[model samples]
Target chain A: MGNDVSFFSNVLYMASNVQMIIAVLLGALGGVFVGFLPAFGSPTAVALLLPLTFLMPTDVSMVMLAGIYFGANFGGAIPAILVNTPGTPPAFITAIDGYPLAVKGKAKEALFVSNFSSFVGCILGAVMFYFLANVVGKAALAFGPAETFALMVLGLACVAGLSKGSIWRSIIALAFGVAITTIGIDPLTTVPRYTFGKIGLYSGIPFVPAMIGLFGISEAILLLQKGKMFEGDKVEEEKALNTKANGPTLLERAKMLPTNIISSIVGFVVGSIPGAGATVAGMMSWNLARQRSKTPEKFGKGAIEGVAASESANNAASAGALVPMLSLGIPGSSTTAVMLAALMMHDILPGPLLIVEQPGLISYLTASYIIGGLAAFIVFQLSIPLFEKLMYIAKPIIAGLVFVLAVSGTYFLRNSLTDIYIVALFGIIGYLMKHFDFPVAPTVLGLVLGGGLESNLRLALKIGGVGELFTPIASFCLLLALIMLVLPTIRSRRTRNEESQVM
Target chain B: MNRIVGLLIVIVSLAYTIGALKWSLWTEGNPGPGLFPVIIGIIALIAGVMCIVEGVIPVNGKQTLIQGLKWSAFLVALTVLVVFLMEFLGIAIGSGLAFAAVLTAGGYRRKFLLILIPIITTVSIYLVFGWWLHLPYVWIQ
Candidate 1:
């Protein structure tokens, strides 16, 4: 506790530096700018700027990047509330109630709740990050190969749970991703596996190219297919929704404090679990709030409580994501995984030893989140009218700008043509998957978890004296996977039977 | 399309499993190269079977196999085309062309998009990566 205070004081002192302040401000501003734009999220932003971080001190660079992350999270809600477009995956749920509110001529109120909830959620998450750092960090370090493998298995099973459509298709995508991961050298042995004698395959499929192809290019294709940049009806409605501001009064806002607190707590707990991110947090919190609301039916129609619940949950989830990243060195989402990559680039491994070795860094990071969150709140509050104007921009221009950014970002990663090709390929895949109603998130998760699962499984086998392959933990994970695979089918069958009976 | 995709995946999984089976499962010390892949391949094959069965059964309002084919074909063509272009033009040029073509084909308008997007993208790549960060343009090499 004493160490924490000293660390906090030291961070506050460091943050007072002019250079650090400027970096934070720039990062916060940049985060909001990128987050406001569709198809550009924090991960891409961080990846684009990662190389530049080499020029700054590691602590300052991390602080700035962290600021960008929090800023993006805050900025994502603006488009979601006013335009019905989620700037990030987590903001999708925000759009559910937020858009309705916008249509109901309460756009400002919805935006206010979103901004406030995000601020509250971020502070709550930072508090959790500060308190749990020592305990969670240690547990993360103690995980062996077997435990890590089991965790990956659990993550894959969670992906199965999150898959919205045909579970079989999701499993197939997961399998394909795993197969792609195996295309490189075997972890236990130096011998190559599925490289097909290609030198590039020896190192496995590079993640950046695959990610760019899947999300960025695929999204571009889909946007084109939709035939217009923005939906005409949505644009008309938004124009009408942009009426005079009649936001909540200070007392009215104060009355919702308890709800924000509860939602933040719920969001943090959900976010701490791997593969469970802001989307789930938002959905869960919104549902919980609805169930507890006096008028549940008002949720989808334009409920301030619904907006608050979703925003709080999503923001908290963003913070909660850091828990696993900091403690277990496991990323809770794609964005966090990218942050992990950035940390690795800096040679700063996050685990049990992180806090002990660099106590000040954790405090610094925590302080950055607080500062970033505050900065985001201030920026959003001041720039609501300006951001609202962005809705009028033509879709082609926005898409064009996004395309340029994605292209440049991919090129900067490795300058490899293969990477660009991979991005295009994935982009097409992402587009088609959307058309077919297959969830794209699981595919990303599968890709991210694939190498970890493979390497750890091999390592655990090597460590367990060969015959111990079927240890209790391994069996437990396999059993869990089996149950996850089977249970969904059974549940669907049961639901169908019940419906038939009712009919 | 659903049945074809399912079948294709199954075949791929089978092929991979066969290859994995041929490798030593274990040596004196290290785990064998095939150990994890073979298991994954087998599970994938099972999943493929489930997908094929589901495709044939037509539970709920799922798209018909033929409907799936159109999308699958378009995407596969796009991917192959992009890969081909990448070999000749390099990442930036290839990506810009691919992006413009794909977007336009998808129904995007504004002729200026093709010109403006590519140029801006290329220049940005040069400034941030080549000039600012000092990362080598490997594709150029």
Candidate 2:
């Protein structure tokens, strides 16, 4: 109890700092702006801003970035609910129910619920960060090279699980990613592996350029092929689409409280695990809610419960991602991975000694999230009508705008044309992969985890001796990967046999 | 398309593994540079082989590999074009062109879309990176 009070007071003191306050407001504003824009998102935003952090105080810069990180999640829900276009990846699930609600003239209700759920999730996550910081930090300290390697393998294996298509294809993508990671200098020997005599390849594949190519450029191509799938102008024609005019009544809002609470818990738990983020949480929650609901058929048709479940889970996942990042230095999602990078840039090592080293920093970071969430909720609610109006704009204009932003953002990273080329190259790769039902996310996951896995594996082998490669931790991770790889094959065969029988 | 992709990956992996084996798989005092790459190459080779086999042998009425290739060409073209442009024009200009081209190709017919999207996107990015944030612009020069 005494510790809690001390932590609370420390947070208050940190928040009172004029510099920290300014940082929070700036980050929150940046987050909202990026979140509202379809092309701009947290990772790109961070990459664009990475250079600037070199000039500012590490703590202030990190706090500001963290604020933007959470703020984006909060702001992302607006476009998703009103326009059916997810401004960020986490909001993809939100569009499932949110767009339907908007189509049904329940846009205001969707907006309200989204904001409310976001606020609830942020607060819950902040509380967890504050109370459990010490415990998590200590646990993180115990993780060594072997455990880290295992964790990476587990993360890569998840690609098979999360992929919508054949697991075999996903594994192929994952392996491709791992292979790409080996293109630069060898971690142990410092000798070049697949650089092909190129100086640029010495550093391995640059993350920002590769990511821009993978997510940003690829998406543009896909969207272009589909030809303005989001025609917001059609919304104006539907007089029944004005959700604000016929908002949910107070009693109805009250009834959703229980659903929101349950979904938030589900989001938080799933989010705290490394690799799983809002997408998984949202899908899981929505599925559970549908299973529990009396009318499961209403799920795809704009059910209020669906909106609540998805929104709550996604928002909670945003908060939950912080858990592993703060405790173990392992990012729970891509966005958090960027955040971890930001922290590293600031020289703030996020591990066991983090709290002891900077007592008030954890408290302040937690408080900043709370404040950011509240601010985002208020700002998002107030701008609902305006955003709804923006959705009526033509699709061509939106696509054009998004493409430009994505390109420019990629250019900003390291100011190199090489990066731009990488983006373009990946964009094509991303597009082709999609056309052939080759999943892009696994590639991204592979890119993100590939370097880490290889480096750690080498380091662990060096430290533990060649014989130690078969240690419990390494063996365990390998076993898990084998299971992940084999299980899908078994499942697919069984399903095929069953279908043949039915035929 | 699947078969080509698989074949390309397999060939690349096999070539890289052979190169790595020649360079150094293991040394007496320290681990060789080729060790990790060799492992990754082997994995890639195996996966590529599996993918190719799957492409060759259909499981449940999936599209033929050649059918997949036709659809993938446009994307590959777009990628190659962007990469070439990025080197000559720089990131901002190259990206703006790519964006405009892709969006236009995507069926965005409005004249305003082409003009406004590029201008707004370029200017806003300039402000964020060049003016407000003052990040060093490497691609432009």
Candidate 3:
């Protein structure tokens, strides 16, 4: 109870911190700006912004990142509503009802519905996060080295197996990631492993530069190849945002409060599971809302509730996905995985002890979500026209800009040309992997978790030999990993067999 | 293409596995640094072989051209040259050159965008990273 009071006081303290508040607000605005562009998701935004946070205080940087993380959810729905272009995969569901409304000249009502629902979803998710994260943290305190190893395995397996690509390709990506982790000095031993006698490789490939390269530069290359960014007609903003249109009023949109609540709950649950990210959460919640709606026929045809359902759920899931990262040091989504990597870079270890060690972080993060959501709502509300204009910038120009940023940002990491070279290498590797339909998230997660996985395995072995892996918690986690890995193959086989039977 | 990528992966993993063997697989009855790499290598090798097998199966779509490869290669080479000439050329000029080249290659024939946007972006980078974050890069002196 005393701890509760202290936590709230810290939250109040963070709310008062001018720098942190400004950081959060700036991050929110930046997130919204990035979300306006297609194919630039939260992971890319966070990765690009990471180099800037190197000099900041850990709490401030984290809050800023948290702000961006949630703010993007709000921003993502705008493009979906206006242009039928989902800025992020999760927002694809939003486009179903949103774009139809735009076509029907009710884009204003749809935008309001999306904005309000996203804000409410963020609040609900933050509330749930405040309670559930602590519970998960307490439970995770029981995890030993063996359990940790098993958990990391589960993390790797979940990413590789659950990816949209073939499991073999995903595993190949994972293996490649793990291989990258093996470069430089071995964590367990003092011996050099894959450095190839380079003097600068003593610390291994820097995570920030490599990430910047993989996500930033590779994406730029792809954008270059694509030529154009937006294909739908120019988002006739005046027509879209006409205030006097015979569209649903504020009160009518408010009627979606119940749908928002139920969908947020669904989203929160789905997001708490690793590898089932906001895209899945948004889809699940939107479908459930459709099933339960009184006016089911209105779905996918400009139902304001549909927009509310997807936007709310995906936003909530963004918050929910932080539970595992904060509590167990295992990221619940790819964005949080990048966040986790950034946290580790600052030497701020996350896990069961993190909450106890820095109880203020949760409060600050919670406050960030509230403020960031409100800020995003306000920004989107007033500046819809501004974002519309931003969408007009050519993709090639954006690609060029990203290219320069990627080069310079990477150079700023260690102020070394070698880091730049490493980034270029990884950029090519990332591009190739993308070309081959291999998932990249697993590789990032694998690299981030690789050292921990190795160190934990060594520690667990020293403590209890090979038999330690069969301990209840360890075995349970391993079983979960195995199940995740095998389920996809089985499901695909079944799908193939059913298709053949149909033929 | 898939077969070549798979074969490359196989060779790399095989070499990696061999390289890992140079280190002690175990020390004091515990798994050593090499053991994990060996395991990872084997997994990669298996996945590579699987990839090779999967490649044999026919697919529907025609293989697409590696469009924009020339531009992509030019961008990479320009970036390398920029880095190499950082002391002489500085960030702003190098970035502008790279940006203009890419924009031109991407079919932006508009002289205004090709010229103006690069300057704007270069300045923005300077203001954001150089001024705000104080990134100690060699800029136009």
| Candidate 1 C-alpha lDDT tens digits along B87-114 | 5654455556655654565455667765
Candidate 2 wrong stretches, greater than 4 Å: A1-26, A35-40, A43-66, A73-121, A228-354, A357-361, A380-395, A465-482, B1-6, B29-31, B56-109, B112-114, B135-141
Q: What are the chain B TM-scores of all models?
A: 0.57, 0.58, 0.81
lDDT tens string, model 3, A362-390? 76667666766777777777776564444
The whole-model lDDT of each prediction reads 0.69, 0.66, 0.73
Better of 1 and 2 by DockQ: 2
Preferred candidate (DockQ higher): 2 or 3: 3
lDDT-superior candidate, 2 or 3: 3
Q: After superposition, how far is residue A28 of candidate 1 from its true place, in Å?
A: 1.4
Per-model DockQ: 0.32, 0.33, 0.49
**Candidates by DockQ, descending order:** 3, 2, 1
The residue-by-residue lDDT of candidate 1 on A1-503, one tens digit each, is 11454546746765687877777777777787777655555676666556656778876777678778888888878767765545666775677678788877788888888999999998888888777766654544555677657656754764554444467777767777777777787766777987778987788887656755565555545444333433786467556765777789999799778778888988887677655567656766776676578876576677888888888888888888887887678787778888898888888887656677677667767877787787777777888878666545554444444455555455555656566556656766776666565656556656766777777777887787544545676567567666766765675577679989999
DockQ of 2: 0.33
**iRMSD computed for candidate 1:** 4.8
